[model samples]
Target: MVFIRWFLGKCILLINALTLPKPMLRIKADQDKVDKKTQFFTLYQFEACPFCVKVRRFIRKNSLKIDLKDAKNNMANKSELVNNGGKHKVPCLKIEKLNEKTMWLYESDAIIAFLAKETELS
Candidate 1:
């Protein structure tokens, strides 16, 4: 059962890699805006997670530059997710606002929507 699950996960990852969407063209003004918005955002994810793949695809398709933190093998990142976010959830996004306030966002759909809305202004 473990082997089957691992194999299926690998297959899903392979499919995702093979069908990556082309990134959107970023205009100078839009890029600048996006850069600012993404500068403080970090995405915590595991490489093989389907939800993470969805969020990653959205980031790539929209040409967003948010930093990705791999929590699978990285102890520090994993701990950060648990300690700060209150749980070690894949596809969690850490958003830091200009006011020095931090927001830990979970769930892939909500993260994608928030990112899309933020970038739409650019």
Candidate 2:
């Protein structure tokens, strides 16, 4: 079972690398503004999870530069996901606003939708 999972993970990564999507082009000022907004977001994910990959592909294709925290291999990240985020789930998005409470968003489709709405980059 472990070997199968490892093999599938490697295959998924290879496919992701080969079919990497190109980012959409934006004016310098517009892109800068988007970057500023993305700085407050962090994605907690496992490198090989298919759902995580889906969110990552959308992020890359839209040129969103959100931070990625590996919740699988990194113990600290795993703990944070479980404790603060209230769940151990991949593709979880952590949104930190200056005066608002932090938001922990889960599920790949929901994450993608939220990102699309927030960044206007779907």
Candidate 3:
């Protein structure tokens, strides 16, 4: 009975860890490069969402310039980004570009790769 209880307890702990939201690193911009080529990769994500965390990690670690849109609690941004994206999904990216629109790009990995190429610091 003791062993069974211990095993069950461990399993429960594992499940909790797996279900918990992943943490993300939020960084502040240091320069005034806002009005350049693109208006930074506008990202809509939550601090605990894993997929969102990954994208943020890439941006933070590389110190890439980006406009973060927190959609978990910010209902206005949530509706705009998610509804605009047509899936109400977190971690949605908004690439502001002239000759193109938001449909110009979508997807986390793709956005990450684009930043990596541009920054060349990744």
Best candidate, TM-score-wise? Answer: 2
Clashing pairs in 1: none
Clashing pairs in 3: none
Q: lDDT by residue for model 2 over 28-87, one digit each (tens)?
A: 988988898899999999999999999999999999999999999999999998999999
Give the candidate number with the greatest lDDT. 2
**Tens digits of lDDT, candidate 1, 21-48:** 9998977987888888799899999998
Instruction: Compare candidates 2 and 3 on TM-score and give the better one.
Output: 2
- Best-to-worst order by lDDT is 2, 1, 3
**After superposition, which runs of candidate 2 have C-alpha atoms over 4 Å from their true positions?**
none
Model 2 CA lDDT for position 96: 97
Q: Is candidate 1 or candidate 3 better by TM-score?
A: 1
Query: Against the unseen true structure, what C-alpha lDDT does each candidate score?
Result: 0.92, 0.94, 0.64
Q: Model 3, 5-107: lDDT tens per residue?
A: 6676566556555654443333334223322433556888765565666676776565556788777688898888766777767667777666766552456
**Winner of 2 and 3 under lDDT:** 2
lDDT of 3: 0.64
